[model samples]
Target: MARGSLVPETAAHAATTVARATGHRAQVDVTSDGAALAALGRTPLLLRVTAFSMFVFPSSMVIKDIGAAGTVPMILSCLLFVFWLASWIWRLHDPVRVRHPGRMAGVFFVLGIIVSYTALYGGWTGDATVTGLAAADRWLILAFASLGLILVAAESVKTMADAMQLLRWLLAGAFFCGVVGLIQFTLRVNPMEWVQLAMPGFTYNGGDTPFQARGNLVRVAGSTFHSIEFGVVSAMLLPLSIWRALYDQRGQRWFHWLQTALLVFAVAATVSRSGTLASVVAIAVLLPFLPRIARQRTIAALPFVIIALFVAVPGFVGTITDALGADTSDPSIATRVNNYPRVARMIDAKPWFGVGPGNYTVQNAQEILDNQYLNTIVSMGIVGLICVFIYLVLPGVAALHSARHAAFPALRCLAGASAAGLAVAAVCSVTFDSLSFPTFALSYPLLVGLSGAIWIMVKNEGSSPAPATTTPQTTRMD
Candidate 1:
């Protein structure tokens, strides 16, 4: 009896010892994982670099020797793509484990561009200074770089903190552009001129003037290539600013609200119908998902905001109204309408792949299409246009899906905001060749990447076990 009792006690002691050892090991593992994530949280370095290149430098600024291809954002994007490829090849740890549909669509879109370009390799003819082959190569480079930005941006977000940091940087960029627009609109001065004076080896190629007039209102381009581009980008970013203002726990909320107001004013300063439409679309998309109080507040503020715009920029409201109500005979409206038959004819020739990408220059076509949808069809044909549609539409859909499934309210708000921004991009694409403008082109891809990042986070959170502690958890456990 004594021997049996001793045996049971020894067994119990060994079991307790093993349990304690396992718990200690787990604690160490969690700590190490937390450390790794914390490290990741600090490495939104690529995002910051990309944002700075996109927003801080004048969109018109290009390398003195390299022209359009030498723009800082373009160069950075290419480098980023190389880095992304190297990381993948080396099997670096990526927080986003799942293959997001948006990312896949982007890849397929790039492939489609290559295929289209390859199919028409030797038979292309165009009136542009750049040869068909050279133009196709440039377009392919841009496509790869854009895809690189999306991939890197999507992979950069390892935690909610990283996501917030990215949003904050984007908001800051928008705020900077807003302030520049305000200065240009009110003071009739281009801050980029001053920027140029302060720095040499950069040339501004936007246009003869940074400020233009629409009726009695001064139109501001800010740092973008055109006032329309500036306005559209501001409108697209407005939803994220609103989200930050409403839900962000970091810093003073009033500051974010101020940013939101600045973005709205910037959009109005452009006196662009497309910008106005984009802003309205974004707000409409966001309104349904907002909290009741927030929705009510937005509704209540509309009249006051309109009044303020009218008061501050005297002819702003009327200018937008007039532009929207402009007749089909209006030059811009007529140009877009006239391009349809031309584009349709061009599409009929190749239909499947059309002419190679970037071959549909103004010199060849006799006029710019101005509509990205039509432009894609003319340049890349039906397959490329389908890819473009999927690339543009899937991110927003995925983001909304993430919002619906997100466990955290903040994540849901972010997803909703991203979706709203993407909606603006899609709606604005029809009004202008958004991809032709540096600011909108870069900004759109960033939004796509961010939406993808949000989708990954939401999915990761939903599928993984509850974190042991709030200090950043890894998706996997050993």
Candidate 2:
């Protein structure tokens, strides 16, 4: 009797010890404290560099020495690079990690360089003058290089959360800008001028202006590349809103609905076919993913709500239908289709590195060609296309992986929607590259969103491997 009691008691003690050890291991945060700071510092710096480079260019145009204007981004980039290096060195002892599709993305990004370098060589024409270089095309070249670098670096560091926060900032900014545009329409004012507030020296000067400005609606592009580019930005936000809607509860996160609605209105005010089309496409793709409960609830309320809103605002239904119209008379549409085949033929001649970045505008004599894929090939070459491919593909891979591991439905929706949105946007890009315009900053956030999704996916997935051994380690000082 005594021996039996002792055995059970001893077994219980041993079990308790093992359980404690297991809990300790599970709770451990393998990440050294310095790792996170280094990552964070590196991540936001990318945003700063991009904004500085592009924004400075426009304001810099004000300065006579173009080189001085150009040097701003260069200096910012160098400074950011220095900071990143020092931070990495501080956290050098921490383990570096990345999972599957991210690896594939990194590989693809490098491959795209072939296309970039091809463009660099093929389009040079032994005339290396910046003045001789394609004016708008110069931005294209910078875009390619920047995107390639951003892709590889983002993947290498794996900063998904940082990306998400940036995207939120982007979408919120876009939404507010959309509101300003709506306000402009209400006040019967120039929307572009209002957008210039955030970007002190920014101004929009082009559009299909006629004798009456009404025929030539100058959509407020905010800090984006162009009004048309703003359309793409608006399109990108719709999916983000949907993702939020799917992930968040109405009571806890009503802002998702509000933001989404405002975004839709923004899209309406822009009157951009591409932007509207992108929004419709993004929402349409997201529709099937709605939960049965949400879908049912929406079905019950949506009809009445939509009808009420339409009745309250007579122009609402008309605006929607008008937007949906596939009236082929649009010259911009016709112009794009007509130019495409010619650009394709040009690609046939210089497929490896199509022409040179921004050369299409110059070669075509300062025209808004408005085709991203064609422009890419024409500017950088096959190599440029490859690099562009890398920039887009890696984030997608990260998003897909994130979707697989997302603990929250909203996060999953965000990840999936961003991925799908990018996919759709890429399709749009083949025909249109809005990132080139001075008013188009929406693409920046979209890119960041995709990159952010990847970072979240990686971080969550990484944590799964270690469990939650959350120890306080000194984060490397970035």
Candidate 3:
């Protein structure tokens, strides 16, 4: 009987020992897992570089010298090259889906440009002047480089959280530039002179006017080369700012509302008719995506809001009317309008490959076409036009698809905003030669990539299995 009692006691002790061992192992695992998770929370160095690079890209080239303007993207390309090399060496697996039909179309577009470049310019001899086809050819190279860098950024984003981080950086940069533009407009100051003073080699075209004063009003170009570019950036941000103001209730909602107001004011100060129209279109596109209550309220308040705007701002309607009237009588407008037939003739002559990439300036006798569609057909022919269109349009289509199908309200809203921005870009391209300006050219493509990233995340989240639930227990010895 005593022996039986000893055996039972020993058995209980053994069980206790086993339970203690299991608990220790679990504690170690939890600690190690937590450390690993913390490590994972840190962003990659390459991604950080890319994000930083993109943030400064739009505003960095105050000095128009090749060495100065090209430095940012050149550095970015080197960093991205390093990342690419490391990925190959380490066999790293990227979680983001980099392959899309739109991106592929962009590749073909680049190829089309290359073919045109070869056929027209006889390849880069590095001795060409910075006028006509040579200048366009150089920009073509820059475009390809910019596109690659953007792709790297798009691929680096693994989740919506990652995308938001990148987006915040981008928005912050754009806003900073906008503020600079506001200063230029309000103070009648040009920051370019200061920039030139700071950078000895930087040269400003004496003829270029960043602050074109019209009576009491001024056209502000911000940190960019032109007012149109500034307007484009403002228009692009309008939809995003509106979305954040309306829906993003995470924290500091007032800040977003403030951003929206500032963006609207900035667009107005630009006095760009296309920019204003683009903002209107951007706001309109979000109507269907808004909740029923919000949509109805907004619609009801819109007329009153319009009345208040016209009442509050002196010469508000006149600003728009001036732009419209100027379009009819402005020599620049007349020149651009007259170029359409010339462009049509150019296309008819070289219908297949056109005049070559970036050859329009030379062909058009240095007159700006003011239309990207006409410019593309004149420069790159029908094939190039198709490729460019696909590259620009497909991402918008994907965003629209995600907007329609996404279960998450945030993602859906973002997708809608992206679609709206793209629509605005397309329409505005008619008034501006979009590809000529880095602010307009680089931004639209990056936004497209962002939409793609969001769509992928939404798709992945939808397909992921639900987490299994397990009940907690007071003791492990059950």
Candidate 4:
């Protein structure tokens, strides 16, 4: 039978047939086992559970209690760490198959953070609600968990298909976030209020308030703790939705297109210039490599989409106008700008070791320094800055490496998306600490893992078995 004719039920039978035809019945059971494992690997449940947990678990409703310690993402991160450890012990997958090429860089980054934090031990002078040691411990826990995620992908994910599958699920979660954000924007409905009502005794951090605004328009916070969190989540989703709309032309193509629009509208409604800018950057980088027809159609429709958005949504245009406006009179913008000098001085004082992981907010209690780079420098010092470069910038580094090495053509798209996503995130970080929010924070390591996984597949493809006919790449796109 032809390869395409083989269904799941026949897959084992087909394997047996092939073995029998080759007079290798003695090896038939082995062949069947391999085929079964292959089929199991292609199952979507693992990706779905992992992605959904990562995306949705950060909500207050998902937490068992009010404190950061009780948050679902934190618990999930620990579980992910345990999973990685188990995988390591059981030799569940090739130990070195999906190595984080930036492992050395990661070590340096972590060391830098430790040294910085240790250097500032007992030196904290700020009035933080939490002690410096406690803050440092929280930061360390997150850092280690982020590292585990990278390692998990490295050890378990064996192909480009697996990496992209996780990405698809993440995009699905992002779509849900976008939909909720749209409702919040349209009706001014607070999902947090609903969560609070349903889950009694659930308290919100002062920072996790239900409403935020820019000028005269109320921003959409979605199910996340804050509007900026929702904006950043939407920003990250925007590119993936566009990539899906442009590429995946199989089933329900219009649905993908609608997903793309919802993500765009979600970003706009948040009235966040950084988030909107990040989406634009991702799309800009993504456009060049796309099939020509998709590129042109998407670009051509932009003007009409913008016009329709303004006409249909109340305060849409004005919200965007006020957001991007050069009005230093805008309190948020002014505060962010005015505080730069103080951050610069802080960084200068601790050029090597930073003022510890959680010192900045306490030290500069009244000021909100929106810049992530500055935040890193002051918080973790130059070493922390280097770590940021390794994780965030190295994906693009791997992408460029693959491009030069003539990796798989499909990998080019994944690399481009990864590079663009990270770039957009870096830009967003400059306006708001993108890595500080739970959703955005978790997203970074997840994407990093995906990037590393893709590079590993491309790097090892020459020796690996040819992709199955049921591979996602084969089914989802050309």
Using lDDT, give the best candidate's number: 1
TM-score of each: 0.84, 0.66, 0.77, 0.80
Error of 4 at 45 (Å): 5.1
Residue-level lDDT of model 2, residues 1-478, one tens digit each, is 1212312134334333222211212221214322321233223434433433433233222213333223333333333333333344454322144234433453454455444544455544334445534353345334434433343334333333344444455555656556555555566564544333444332323332211221334354433334556556666667766555443322335676777776666655555667657765666555544444554554586467567646543465565465456454756556666776777777777677554454554445324567666666776677777766655555655655665565433344556566656655665665466434433422433354344535534455445443232211101001
Of 2 and 3, the candidate ahead on TM-score is 3
lDDT of 4 by residue, 282-368 (tens): 788776655455567769988998897887677778777766876788777788778878878887777776777766664453486
Q: What ordering of candidates by lDDT runs from best to worst?
A: 1, 4, 3, 2
- Please give, for residues 73-147, the per-residue lDDT of candidate 1 as tens digits: 787777666666654444443424546766886787688788788766745423334577677877787788788
Cα misplacement distance, residue 33 of candidate 3 (Å): 25
In Å, residue 23's CA in model 4 sits off its true spot by 30
Error of 4 at 294 (Å): 1.5
Candidate 4 residue spans exceeding 4 A from truth: 1-47, 59-66, 90-94, 102-109, 121-130, 196-206, 246-251, 362-366, 400-409, 462-478
Residue 178 local lDDT, model 2: 60
Model 1 regions lying over 4 Å from their true place: 1-40, 94-96, 124-131, 203-209, 363-366, 463-478
Our tally of clashes for model 3 stands at 0
lDDT of 3 by residue, 169-273 (tens): 566666666676767866878765565455443344342347765435677877665777777777777776665555442447677666666666667767777
- Candidates in order have lDDT scores of 0.71, 0.47, 0.59, 0.60
Alpha-carbon runs more than 4 Å astray in model 3: 1-82, 85-90, 94-97, 123-133, 195-208, 213-216, 246-251, 292-313, 325-327, 330-332, 362-366, 465-478
